[model samples]
Target chain A: MSESQQHHQSPGSPPASGLGLALFWVYVLLYIGFMGLVLVRPDLLSLRPFFGVNLAIVYGMGLIAAAFVLAVAYMVLRSGR
Target chain B: MLHETSIAAVTIFATFVLGVIGLSFFLGRKGQSASGYYAAHGQIHWFVNGIAFAGDYLSAASFLGICGMIAFSGYDGFLYSIGFLAGWVVALFVIAEPIKALGKFTFADALDSRFNSRGIKLSVAISTLVVSVFYLIPQMVGAGSLIKPLLGLPHEAGVILVGVTVTLIVVTAGMVSTTWVQFIKGSLLVFFCGVLTVLILGRGLAVNAGREGSENLTPQIRTVRPDGTVLVDGQPQSRDHDLRPVGTIIRLPERFAGQESTGPLGPLAYLATLEDSTIVTWATKKHADSEGVHTTYTPVERPGTELLKPGGFFKGLASGNLPDRLDFVSLMLALFCGTASLPHILIRYYTVKDAAAARKSTVVGIAVIGVFYVLTLYLGLGAMTSGALDPTDTNMAAPLLAKTFNETLFAIISAIAFTTVLGTVSGLIMAGSGAVAHDLVENVCGVRMTDHEKIRCGKLAAVGLGMVAMVLGILFRNFNVSFLVGWAFNIAASANLPALVMLLFWPRTTRQGIVAAVTVGMLASLTWILLSADTFEKVYGLSRDLALTPFSQPALITIPLGFLTLVVVSLLTPAPASLRR
Candidate 1:
């Protein structure tokens, strides 16, 4: 705990970051759900078109963007706490 | 003259190589101690280390193989980039902080932190070596494939060239040099690729009429004789080589029938216009007759609509074959779970100062990596219609796409591709050397060495691993690097991820349990891959039905088995008091 504010005291701080852990599960769930949809209903996944691209492309882009967003969100929450 | 070996390109590539090697020598003086050698004294800036993470992670497979795959097979290739980028999520949120907190030098250091068991150290050291070697093969193969066009050297020569060069970098300064090299390489790679993408958008899509509207994208054949000569389309390729460049839109939709191309379209408009058009994609079919091995490159015309779909590369998904579907699912599972599990990636945590720095660096890595992957979609599509693809070697897609712009752009891209391989191979060698010197010799074998001796031992290990990588790369030159990387991911996920996750989260994890899980996971995945249908058909030249494994990928079954073995063994044996909290 003393190592949180101090940069050079310890080798590394003990890991108790709940935000990163929580987001880990969140991202995992999202990925599983995405893959499941792709396997179960390929047609439905491809049916919805957005911005001249199909639902699959849209979803894939959304997933990548979500990863970046979630990572930033975790960073903010960690620093804020 | 477009695809011929260019003197200007070779000069540029030589300059880049000399600059990288010189940078390594300059940084070599800082790594005298073991900590500096292995972890860069934990002084690297979080942002620089973060970009370095991207450099180490991208490898040749991500830059060259994925782009080539997309240019040839369409959307299926982008799925790889997606799966790869998503894996960083696991690294950021789960592994980054805890791994930094627990380990000092190697991944084995983290797992063995609670219990100083020699068995655990020995098992983990061996596991790291196996994973690192598997990962090194593709990077070496990618270097081999890249050098052929860039310098007109044979593939085997390229493998040895990179192998020796990377070994020198690791041996000179260890992690200090490796980190900075990766940082410079990563930034250059992403920047140049972004530049290439902008150029792609500027030139726009074209129906390649080959200076005449009546031209067609025809199939070209290549025969490799026992004497090591290459005959292209039933004739000996000239001194500069014979296989002409390929990849183009042979036909447009009815609305654009009068025009040779839809010039200067926007990014979104490019995709929309491409969707309505018909493009020529090549497929290679091989036959071994009395003369020798003959491979025929066949051109297939497909609508842009179907090309944009996901079923081309992974045939099982579209064919509705249950076993094939299982293989696809398993490969994806591995990629999703593999990033944090990789030894080179794990060692990166130690390069930064603390857990917070590690976290920040991971966040930075994910952002850079994510953006690059999105750009791959544009680059791949741009290359698919670039009109400079070499139908025989899909790996040449990105460089060839740059060639469409100018000779200078092509030279820069190829040199950067080679740098991509160098940066990744150095990191992997560093990991392998650490495993050998720190874990195997010192901790496991109970050999005491001075600080100076440890560095010497690590350097020896790097040289040995580099030689092994060179041999394997030459042997497996025919396989696509992305596909080889998938096997590496599957093995890493199965062998390492289970033990890592359990040790961090589960209080009941025993040292014995970890040793068992790693050994079982590593051995099982390797065995499964050896007996897989794909390996039988491709490597052994046997019928697919004769393969022992039901599917090619081992992650679907092996990953769970790793967890199961760990949990069951931990329960059966009581946790040692030394390990208990």
Candidate 2:
């Protein structure tokens, strides 16, 4: 109900910065690689025997794990900055 | 609808609903300020806000739909999970901090933060409401499915129960209660699903010859007549005809040829072993006969290797045709782009204190959500082989899978699923209300109300949206359109994503461009879906061949249209005095 300003950022600079853009591109590429496999060479996704699991499952699980790790990496980068 | 009505289910359902309502009232006391009412005064802990992200995001579609999809189709079902989780990456990195830095209450706040365009407010607000409504229907429909088993109530009654309860929760507390409810529901859902997954792994994979009297491993065929009469094998079934509840392992892998069970297997081992087994999956055929609709469900046995392939469910990938392939890619694109574009999810950013908190919360959310998605693969596959699947209703897979284990697990799972509906529905209603009160009424309509007046209007909007959801839920109850939610994603991506991405990255985007892009993008996707072949066959009850569109999904066309519209419109029009940089 209140109309008062409560925005957190200093007014001048936008929030989408260099590091954020880098991370976004990284994720976009990873996703593209996965989807490309599904499209151009789906058989590649099914390529198997890594830890007794097929390549598709491993890759799928890897994407999830990698997202987590990358996010954690973002936190590290942000903190360091 | 898949389980027997038991005392435990009733007790658990009642207790959980009461507890949630109580929590709403308890949390409702503190958020009297406008920011407090809408965004929790940006005071919520980063961690709780993070988990609440999961609660808000994991709607019935995620829990029931994806699980059911995977249970029926194989590796493809998990693709939805990956697409869903991947969207969080965009949210975390690109949208999170900027969104947090920009908006005060609603998603529109951020978009209009720099430009202060009434046109932007009007278009974005309307888009928000439309997407929220489309998204709400599935949640309410899912609510009906959850309640039908626990209370032995009709589907309409279930929809009304959830509508009334969610409305009460939102009207009582606003975002304050919504956040806490989501956090609790999210934690409990993950915790319990993990427990269930453990139970599944412990049981291991076994070739269920058949349940007791149904020892014949061969498939059973049931034909549903146009007059809605049921025929089993070659004879009409008695009045109490059940679809012979199908799904079982017809044969084990060669490695376990003699053994009835493969003992205990690890997560990867379970999938590997199943790949070598032969399982009975159901196939359905529908045709018109004597002015009656006859649909046949035939169970077919297939090797695990085939089931694990992508084409099994998506059809497009399996067809190996170009247009079909494009449709599959478009759907994946929608799922990927849609999360960052959803109004309910976008509004969640305002709950945190600052850009840093918003970023941290998203990271936490991704971690929590990522782990949960992985769990869904196990849950879905476990249900697939649980041998207790209801071929008629895939949405019942998870709880029914619990039923196969024990009554207690079923009771707990059903109760959590009900809360799951409540958690998601509340968040959605909140987003809808904000679209109306804060964005539409206050900003676009030029109605300047005080904070107190705004809260009153938001509550009114919540009640109205709740009523709309209830009606749609009841109307769509018998509708077996599971992937219809893809419509919401497609529209959200095409309409909202273009404006947000351009606003953040492109410098010359005019207010007119933003407004036009949203309007055209939204209408384009909606019209395409309405004219799609799937809609012709499933929704309109007409021949699919008569459809207007080349394929069902519109993202591959409309997403680019949005960006292009913005570009062309921006170039032709001069910037408004307020917008010149």
Candidate 3:
């Protein structure tokens, strides 16, 4: 990279471009899977998977939880780098 | 439904508005510099910025709209909460650090950072303005909705009130005041919502909880005449004569059969219990007569299992048709991709100091936003059983739910909701004004400007955009706030996300590519929305059969179209000198 380009390099740890991309794709797959289920096999979402609540509520809430988990994991992984 | 103005609500609402304006004036001294006015001099703390992200994001759509949707339509409303929060994943993992490293003021600055192309600057700036205005419509409409019950003002008055107040806030201190307002609003919203959730849990669920007589057992009719006179059940609607509030639990689970109420259930238990119950939900049918438009809301008893499924609002999920299913998938994709691309959200990256702060703030934002979205389910369900729903306006679900508990709580929640509009509107106006002054005027138009001149130009743009927001808000008053926000998301995802993603990740992305992607993406999505069935039926007042587009949301098609346009154009043209390395 040129000196000017390097100047704009984000401070702190080295750029986690690969890690970010990997984490992002992981989320993309999960989100797309969600859409896939809703499209192809929506009946699966209504099954009582656990806790007496249906898969629809469980999976929906799980997506939100997964986002937070992945976000914290990214922060931790990047800081350790 | 007629809403009697409450003095307490008016007082609390005024205090909140005046407090926001007061904070703007107090912080006005710090925004003398262009950097300060536009980006808060990049001095905002990560923690404060994080909460402010919540404040800016959890607009009337998230609070009032989602809760109302859930109250009226069951789990479908929670789908919006999920889709909205999911978009932040893209923001945190993909856009956060790079956006911080590249952009100085507006989203255009980031796009034009590599190539000083006026084409890129102009296209991206205009895209930013379009998305901001689209986003502004919901907030302004939400403001109008709140004004009726809180101040007894007309919808237009509420829109004007919010427009004028937000313009003053943006003109006074720009991002500095905007950030603090968001932080305060965000904190209060989450805290009070938490309180309300606890109250709901404590009250628990009851069969016919607040019903007094046979009044709510039958269908209710609300009619609006051509001259704008409203009638309820063939009687003119006044404060004393209004449509009865609806929403009730009709039956309990077999385990709790013959029980009057289930007291103070746990969160998981609450959902599980509601899963087996029978609830009375309203289904509406509308017809136009010489008298005017008459909407009849009929009570329908639905099993809890059906209400907890995906097909209530997105009927395509249940219809099993190819086109309808594609439409549902397309809307979800748009919501997921749109958050990271929003101009108002993107500009916030510049408010903090570094890429690290940006990342940290995003993490903070995700945690706060995630918790609130989870709480939305409980709030919506509680409102569903609260038996205080305004069947005519689903947007009033949450506030009216609070009213069932006590008037004081209702007043406070409504005030918080009003500030929620102010915070979001100010952020949007700031983004719009920055695009106008910093990007279009200075960069694209080649207008030379001093720091003072730039700030002056930005303030003028804020006033202009605020007025536009009010006008559009008034025009689109009947739309569900969350549904309207879906249009904004689709446009943001289609127009901005492809260009931003390709520019950052792909090396061969030329200036011409960015310009082409933005313009094509924007125009395609806007044109598609204008011709879609929903717009034909809702906005144009024509039969949906006359619509051109097969689906309402265009992101699934247009987002890919944007990326393809950029790649093809980039390959066709010779590389820029900078990329020739």
The Cα local distance difference test for each model comes to 0.87, 0.85, 0.90
Off by over 4 Å in 3: A1-16, B213-215
Model 3 over residues B298-337: C-alpha lDDT tens digits? 9999999999989999998899877787888888989999
Compose the digit string of candidate 1's lDDT tens values, residues B1-581: 12468998999999999999999999999999999999999999999999999999988889888999999899888889889988998888888888887888999998888788998899899989999999999998899888888888889988999999999999999999999999989899999999998888777767772345543557778888888777887888785657756668877777777888676777777777778888887778888887778988787888988888778899877888899889989999999999989999999999988878998999999888888888888888888887777776667789888887889999999999999999999999999999999999999988899989999999999999999999999988977889999999999999999999998778788888999999899999999999998899878989999999999999999999999999999999988674554
Tell how far residue B495 is off in model 3, in angstroms: 0.9
Docking class of 1: acceptable
DockQ values for all predictions?
Answer: 0.46, 0.48, 0.46
Q: Is the docking of candidate 3 incorrect, acceptable, medium or high quality?
A: acceptable
TM-score of 2: 0.95
Model 3 accuracy (lDDT, Cα): 0.90
Q: Write the per-residue lDDT of candidate 2 for residues B250-352, one digit (tens) a residue.
A: 7787888787777778888888888888888888776666645555667788888888868877887877888789889999899888899999999998998
- Top DockQ prediction, candidate number: 2
Show the colliding residue pairs in model 3: none
Per model, kept true contacts as a fraction are: 0.43, 0.59, 0.57
Alpha-carbon error at B190 in model 2, in Å? 0.7
Q: What is the lDDT of residue B375 in candidate 2?
A: 91
- lDDT tens digits, residues A18-71, model 2? 887797788889899988888888877676767657777888888899889989
